[model samples]
Target: MDSISFQQYICNLDPTSLPRVVKICSGVYFQGSVYEILGSECCLSTGDLMKIVDVQLQKVTCENMENGHMFDLPQDFKGLFQPIPETPGGTQKKPFSLNPFSTQSKTAEFCGRLYSLQEVLRSAAVRQKRLSCLEIGRSEFQLYPVYKVKAIMHFRNGVVKIDSTLDVEVVDVTEESRDVYFIKPLMLSEVLLSDHRLPVEAEILEAPELPIAFQSDWVSCLSKGCRVHIHSKGSSRQILASSQQGKKGACHYFLLSSSYKGTFRRCPRKFSSTTELALSLGPARKLQVVVTKDHNSSEEMPLFTVGDRLRVLSLARADNPSGMDMLVCCRDNGEEEEEEEQVRLPLFLEAGFVEDLRDNKKYTLSEVVQELQLPCEVKVVPKDAADPLGSVSILRLEAQIKEHCLLVSLANEPSLAFEIPPKWMDVPLFFTEGSEKPSPPTSCSKVEELSEAFYYHLLKLLPSNVPPPPRPPKRRDSKLNNCPEKPGERKTSAAEISKPPFRESKSQESAKTGARQDSLRYPNQYTIQYGPQRPPKPTKPCFQVTGTSASDDSDHDYEELCEEVQKTVHKLQRASIKH
Candidate 1:
């Protein structure tokens, strides 16, 4: 039996100096409790670092410090454990967290999840059994120990309190605690005010004019972990009625119509969808318009301005039996399906239609003709054949033309027409009586004959001869003349070769060969004849002496004497010339 405090036991036991067979001692005192010393200390407190010294049948010997004493411990005892320094504030470490998400232990959470000692041991035992089975016959079976344990409760506030002998607490909140959302003209994020259900209350911090597509549909909102969908704006009355009808504190929302139904509690965190721009044409037609605006619009509400022209399928006022105002409408997007959809405005917006033209005035068919200054009975061509790549088709329709452009009513769609250019019209359209069989127009033959004649005339205009290929440029004089003339041809003399080529190869070769033969035949002859020696004698006098000693002290004072000598010599020479 032993009785010792956890602190004293830890202080006396050296965990790091554990040996294969640890020397366990029976202790009589441990925090005023008497207990028999077992193998190893299995139950470990938080911030108490220890090591397993030895293992026996269902028992272990453990030491707390590298130089401390060892104590026998049972194998079943388990608790949270971590290293605590031996200095002041040694017990500052908190207990290991079972949350699995928090960074509480080094080796325990190495798998990126929290693991308890008991669970770890259990998993190890399971793995050992699985491995034994695999060694026998179940080789295909694999063992994957699960490290994350499901938590009974999750607190988003990130503060956890624990009660035990250690009384540990964990607080982990790294990022800002507030939630942020963005609302744009294209899309918006809303928050749910209640639980999961349809017709729930939601709040858009600052609501903007929503797109027309959002009309008559349910929208989902998520707040924290709860989700809700709503059919209409949450009014106080509807919210009250919903609360009364359903759970008291359930999802709060206003129901636009009891007929509405939706199956979304918590929608995904993000929802992205494009909104189409629509313009109301008349009482019936809605046209899609391509919107060109900044991705991040500055205005709270996106709106169309004046002087914008939207393109749409061609329409004429005459075609409309009601004779309503007509305007060309275009959509901002080019999606194929969207082209067919019309814009629907809310009831409050009295101006249901948005004018596509810069000027507010609407023109009738007659007015359009007058404005364009078009003449009646103009050729009309197919729209497809208007471009250069488009081949002219045989079919032709002529209604009225203006500035080489024609507008002909479409047969299938009377309300719409094809705007054609003059070039698109196939030449020489022939109209035959209904009774007579249709055939190629006779004018086509004439056109062919005329084209042939024009082509032949163009050919005649071109010059008959290409003016013989320009003679190749004459070769310029170059060093190719370095090669001697042909064997039989008159050979150039040394004068010619040396004068032009500078050093003649023939002369250089002869001099080199002769010098080489002389050196080889008389190896030491030249050296001996021109040995390293001074000349035997000088043919000319060293100086014009005029009777002076070879070594004279007067040399130092010769400048004065030399001057007088020069004067007398000059006088003698002048006299001699006179004589």
Candidate 2:
């Protein structure tokens, strides 16, 4: 076994070099033996193996060998750097990071571009304005000296605010590529929601972390490595049920399945069933029950009629009833104003009473959600019951309307076919092949929500890149902690200090930020960040009024501070007019 220290192993790897599996030699040598795999926390035991898929430079603690000063920078710092030249002595190569900033190994960035230390030293601008400005001109001069010369490293495991870089260990990012993820296997819910493409045949890669305790045919589908098809996007509408007999008795005899065969009548609207008559014409919205046949237990009973309409008035102050164990139906004659004339039905009567419904118009799927109660009879209507490509009775809707779902079934098997609910034990498979390539939905989610195991598995099948987040902002309190590394070489005037930092794309402006004016307000490309939504923060002012006055912020140069603004403006105006 080729064993190496954790740092050595990481330093020797890059995006293209991974995913290499490495075993822990000892728990004590690692940073806290506990590991949080893709947000699911678990312990990493000694001798246990983990794959290092990619490396990110979260922060680089750069130590200026010449000045012996140190500071930390995020992996996306945009300042230029030039490698410290050899002491007029030897030769050794170095490394560089290509993310956010594309600085080369050992050699630094200057004048918004990479330059050798000798090249920087040879510039006439560097010799005259070295102490005041970093805006090294190709030929023309600009203001501001290099404020930062540190490296930033980002690692995949740490997920959060881009401005914070990443909360990962300080690692040399050059050893790793700027791309890749450290993820885990798919969750059952993710697999279910993945039917982005309808009718995708899915093979479960892992068993769910939470077991489905309820026993059903679907329970068998939850096993690892089992293949299932993701058919449709489930409906979010609710299906309410009231079982007067019990849970078992209330469920209709028809099973909701693809292979089921059944016939269903349209809900009646005209002189329909007994219950329909009562509700439509009753004074209290009571359901009217019609006597199906004529019979009497007593001789004193009135002459039995084959078609008798008896009004069951007060199902009571009760408005809507569902899933009840018992029903009390009280009836009243239209002419009888007396309570004594009211007839109440026995709860345990052995007689069979059937449900009656009035005809409703042909309902669209959307109409059903807005208008009717489910478990009320419906046709299992397939959108395309006979497509040679196979019937697509269901549509996988990932659009805006996912709030509440209505159960859908085939019109052919209104009883046998059903719509899949948005959540709960739904059609086992969803999403499209559960593609590992991060879609808009998955990529927008916080990194903690991703499954590392599943991500890698998907990568092997269909490889793609996860969009990198915008660089994190510098820490606010960083100024309190870090001081200038080369104070003597980087003195600035009050005029320069008042010049606000430009809001332009730092990466894009790496070479031309010196030309940016304080008034420039370029809109950055909108990038999504993790965490809750917040109102847009206001733009930074040219200068804030702080308690500590800036009498002499940087070393004072009276001649430079008092330089004629008009002279520079005249030069610019003349140059523009000539051009």
Candidate 3:
């Protein structure tokens, strides 16, 4: 292609059209600098002037014409991404108003977002009583808080760029209540447009959205105790702690959620810088004063003291009331809930039974012991437990008792008594101090000497009249004889034994005749009688039989006789047969 067509092709070619073009080629300058284009290569060299000597199908090589050195380049090179130039309004010579109400916005692309040009200009505007200028190299230019947006530039590679204002604010130099000025507020100056080092979305690296005023629970500096709320250039969930203090004596700190844990640094140039995180400076607190004029009016004096706390009626009214109004009852309602739940439980007012720890038995209280029993549920408090006083939780069984609550220290030789509230009885009690129960008296005399008195008293509640049920003696190394180990010798061997003839015994013959006579005389009517009896021993081998008959035989002995006769005949037949 001719030079004209080649230039046209380069202009029409979109670098970002190819998603594979991720790495960016270096040597492209943001300032006015010329780049060399060879036959098939585009040489990008960082210098005032560079001369291209060779070109390849996929590679571009160039030598620094100023230094006269051969250039070594890599393949798959891409053009650099530069920031778009300012819009027409930025280049105009007209002075813009500092008033915020006069701000206007024109639709334009900023940080890849479609923003109004006038809105960005207004954001970049800073109001100050005195003018400030910035020095870059040898050139000096007046600074403005905000600048007008001129245009949006779209590169062939899908990268977009725009000129936006950097946000700044003024803050107090000291914690004192006097109006003092140490430095001028940050002012907006020239527009900064630069190419990113890598191929990345410009919008992604832009500063976060910032609130107008920074808020916090409380921010404390490590070096000083002064608490200050810092605003953000852009809203970010990152808390910034400066290693170095600002021009003013105050250290800049911003509030962020507890979730964020990262380092924060201010960006020196454009707020869109990728390496630097953009943040807003805190605003100065202004107090309105009513100046009284003298006859000359040369010097006006304010009536209010500088140190007085300034409160906005709107804010004061909103916050003057204590936060306690927003709080629910801080006192625990657990006691009320406990009372309701305890109502379902049964009262233990009946004759009390003492659990014998030694025997692991419970015995009923005898009348003698019951007569002396106090109307209280006594629980033994073990030693070395949570209760230092070694007190037991006692609930009075008798409502008539003046002292409904009592404490008997288990640790003492003589149990001591501490009075607790009767309300404690409505719930499962713990000996914690407070509420109706105060801390147990520190001194021993403060408590009654009921110590082991109640312990023994409770032991007295056990029935001394009723004897304990007897238990069988434990057999040592005793096991039931399941089977005999010895084998008995047979009376006769198989060859010597003779087989007996099958014959019915006289008892069986008589039983058959009786059954036949009974069946003929009367129909059988069986009546079953059953009752509980002690289990039989292993050796006794007792069993039961039940049946229905139309006979009048109710005698237990007659039934046993019938069963015995049947067994005898079966045994005889078995003995007659050969083994």
Number of the top TM-score candidate: 2
- Please report the TM-score between candidate 2 and the true structure: 0.30
Residues 1-579, model 2: lDDT tens digits? 334434433333334544444444553435445444334443444544344444554444444334545555444445454333334455433322213333343322333455433333333233222221133322222211122111111212222212112112333232343342334334435544544444444444445444232223334445555654433454332222111233343221111222123222334233332223323332323354545554443331233244544544433221222111122343334345656344433122233233344454565544544454332445444334442112212221111122222222221222322232334333332223334432121111000111334323323443222334434333344232244345354444344444689586877786466335311321221222322335655743232222333455442232233344434545667877999
On TM-score, the stronger of 1 and 3 is: 1
RMSDs, each prediction? Answer: 39.5, 33.6, 39.0
lDDT (C-alpha) at residue 313 in model 3: 13
Alpha-carbon error at 245 in model 2, in Å?
4.2
Find the number of clashing residue pairs for candidate 1.
41
After superposition, the stretches of candidate 3 with alpha carbons farther than 4 Å from their true spots are 1-469, 473-579
Global lDDT scores for all candidate models = 0.26, 0.34, 0.24
TM for every model, in the order presented, reads 0.13, 0.30, 0.12
lDDT of 3 at 504: 91
Stretches > 4 Å off in candidate 1: 1-197, 202-229, 232-359, 362-579
Q: 347-440 in candidate 1: lDDT tens per residue?
A: 1111222223333343333332344221111121223433211221211111221223222221222332222222322111111112222121
Candidate 2 Cα outliers beyond 4 Å, as residue runs: 12-34, 37-54, 62-184, 187-215, 224-422, 426-579
- TM-score comparison, 2 vs 3, better candidate: 2
Per model, state how many residue pairs clash: 41, 59, 33
